[model samples]
Target: MGFNRPSRIQENALPMMLAEPPQNLIAQSQSGTGKTAAFALAMLSRVDTAQKVTQCLCISPTFELAVQTGKVIEQMGKYYPEVKLAYAIRGNRVERGTKIQDHIVIGTPGTVLDWCSKLRFIDPKKIKILVLDEADVMIATQGHQDQSIRIQRMLPTDCQMLLFSATFEESVWKFSERVIPDPNIIKLKREEETLDTIKQYYMVCKRNQDKFTAICNVYGAITIAQAMIFCHTRKTAAWLASQLCREGHQVALLSGEMTVEQRADVIQRFRDGKEKVLVTTNVCARGIDVEQVSIVINFDLPVDKDGKTDNETYLHRIGRTGRFGKKGLAVNMVDSQYSMEVLREIEEHFNKKILKLNPNDPDDLIKLEDIHN
Candidate 1:
């Protein structure tokens, strides 16, 4: 609410979103453009204070995002003290068998669906507004798609729907057509997709094993506030974290394999600046915003199980840094012909050139530090 001026997405969509008769919305904008604030405002405006049942439901792709969105809603609704909010995420302290009396409920799709269908914790019939934050991720991922569809089917007819994400792939767009009928669409052009605040570069390695040395060289050559190194698999992430720690670097690991509590603890420690480096897989790719992350490294470029380059994943991975117009850096480690091909595809897709860096030259690596200065 302290915003002095409206962001582009907020300026364009907020008016139509808060019109007299609510309308379905599908918006695609880059991260850190105030998309969360836009949706949070729309969700809060629809809450019925007198109703004891849940009236507004916001679902995200991950537990971290769910908790973060809930906090945003709370912070924005500071003036409305009576606007009750409930979080239905893993490890949430909400007691079992408790009927959720909150006016707004924020959670992950699977957990929210369970509370609605199995636990009967919240009455779905009374829901007035449904928001799917990071809609593209929830719709494109394998298991998450089915869960999101099932959750949507359970909601009452005529309920207002809002879907927001940084990307809306063709498949995701087709799926959204069926879910949100005659929706008002807002999207950014391809040229406008990449963040101007990020300084992107790539380091070519002679061999696969040389990547670790290249990463360490970058760290030694620059002063990184905090960095997130993205790996293609959990095994790789664990291995990298261990190797970094053994080399006397402060590092932590996060993956889907860890228990929810473990993931939460690692994220909290990193966010609090207790841990300076976090090596993770795609688990922290989307909707996990950490403002202090000035550098993002692709230890392994993101690819699907089929080994094809995942452009959306790449966008989200780099989006982790350069948050909210802050200066940041993204470094890609390309050690093989295949990785180079993938990097080329990403470059063509984003229509931006990623400069090559010679890790052996401290001058090239010092460019990362220059932006921070």
Candidate 2:
């Protein structure tokens, strides 16, 4: 998994990161694009086993991502048995003093900061590598900006810093540059340009009430092996999954409301192909990898307070499919004029036309390469 095969992102970004004199790395890639495994293997390969007091620290915005990344590190460390793995998430009952001083520490920024402030378990002096996973979300949500600054201040100034994000925001860039020493920017191919393998289509509906009808039509029309239905809120995600399940579509729901184990189970079911469609919020719209997902349905268009979803969000929604060079489909259900505008913006940003198809039309599957060519 390390040397034999490299994915597109890995092929482009890994060597620069793993170079002998490692320049600080700032990587921009889409979700499900194997960025985690790239950095995980890199961290494992770089950490010194004999002198260990917390050689690495990886921070994440959400507990789910932190735990998921920590799990990946634990698995990767199997090749080297000497490295120890530890986590510092809130609500976990792990012992304080001795447990957290392992070779690798992964946690949400808040918990790590709290433990350090309280003088519970961590010693930042020994850290040689610092990673900020999902750097965009951390800045977007304002979860722990001050804490991150404080943590960086505590660590040695010479420590190597690596920041990873599916989308690069200006705030992320500014903050990362402040902490990293002349970081090397590594951005993978734009989602639309490199994602020619995904078939994108949209259906226009009259109003919000017509969405249910369109949903049924899509269900009847497509053979969905594994699909993700994106919604604006957690309540909507749960409701849509319930409605689809009642309509006899094997479905599951994911949101911030779920416990860690529950989220893990839902994701496992999705990966195993036991559940055909998953209804989730924007929380699952970044840094999540579901290989069996062949389709993504936008039940409701996402928007910030200014009524914009931004190009990054659009790319992430469609990126759930067409992963690893596989052919996939993305369907957007448009109900209002604003939705149409959003679609136009996406088209212009990607420079690729999206196929407009009727739900009842039998001839809806359009090849993406044909549209681009």
Candidate 3:
């Protein structure tokens, strides 16, 4: 709780959330802008610690984010030692017929659903507060929307509802009406969704190896507090990590195949500064808030399953670096005609220009750093 004062989103959303006769809220704020804390405080304030029941519940799209939210709730509720919390994620198994006595629960949607209905570990009717962190991503992902709707239906009529995320598309907005109808809403304009603090650029590479060399130049030229490299596929991420390792750089690789514990450990180690470079896919893209990440490299430009340009994913990728109004950088590697088309689409979608940079020049990188400073 090193918060000197309430952030913009917190100042506006927290009052409506923590007011008398609790109200439902739908807030949209950029990453690393205290959205989790706003909802965490609201959940903790609504719980009765002496009852030892699961009064508050929070769900995230991925296991890493669930654990991340759990840690924040843990730190903020330090004074109330009696306020116990439990995780309903994979690998944290509970025997059949066991009941959870914790006052707060944080988990992924499927596990949380099973615990509340099938396993009977938590009483859905007894839950007084429900928070869906990263709701846009949660609704967009397959199967998460249905499971979340089920959980929402199980809660009592008076239960307070909260949904938070950085960006929301037209489709997801329509879907929110079914979950929390007629809730107070707050969000930014489409043009302001991508922060001005993050300087954007695109470097044309003749081949994949040139892209790797360009990354090396960026690392050797700039004074990066930390850097995250995002690849669209696991093959590219593995190859880049190995190449960086061969260059005598400490790097970490994260992909979809890694177990929950392994992924959590890798993220924690990167957060602790054990590694300066982390090469990963879109798994860590949504809401992982690491303050030291000064730059992000799109080793591959983001695209949806149908190979169309995904502007929302691109925003989340760059949003990882610039935290709480700090300056950050994003560089995209364009190697093919398809990539070029995707890049152009992204620029037009965001209504901002992505400046061009020479991929082979070391001096060009220094200029970017100078501008960054």
For TM-score, the strongest prediction is 3
lDDT-wise, the better of 2 and 3 is 3
lDDT of 2 by residue, 100-156 (tens): 647888888988876656655777877878898887777777658777878888887
Compared with the true structure, the alpha-carbon lDDT of candidate 1 equals: 0.85
Give the least accurate 10-residue stretch of model 3, judged by summed lDDT. 187-196
Worst 10 residues of 1 by lDDT: 188-197
Better of 1 and 2 by TM-score: 1
Candidate number with the higher lDDT (1 or 2):
1
For residues 1-373, what per-residue lDDT tens digits would candidate 1 score against the true structure? Answer: 6689988889989998898788989988877778899889998999889878899999888888887788788999999989999888876766679889999999888889889999889888888889988878787666887787788888888788988877777888887886776799998645334657778899998664588899889888888889999998888888888888988998989999999889888998998899999999998898787879989999899899899999888988998887766777899999789999999998888888888999888888777668656
lDDT of 2: 0.77
Model 3 per-residue lDDT tens digits across residues 302-372: 99899999888899999897788889999999999999999999988888789999866767887887967
lDDT of each: 0.85, 0.77, 0.89
Order by TM-score, highest first? 3, 1, 2
Task: Give the deviation of candidate 2 from the true structure as CA RMSD.
Answer: 3.0
Error of 1 at 207 (Å): 4.9
Candidate 2 Cα misplacement greater than 4 A, ranges: 207-209, 365-373
Cα-based lDDT at residue 62, candidate 1: 84
Candidate 1: list runs displaced more than 4 Å.
Answer: 91-97, 189-192, 207-209
Pairing residues by index, what is the TM-score of model 2? 0.89
lDDT of 3: 0.89
- Clash pairs (backbone) in predicted model 2: none
- Poorest stretch of ten by lDDT in candidate 2: 364-373
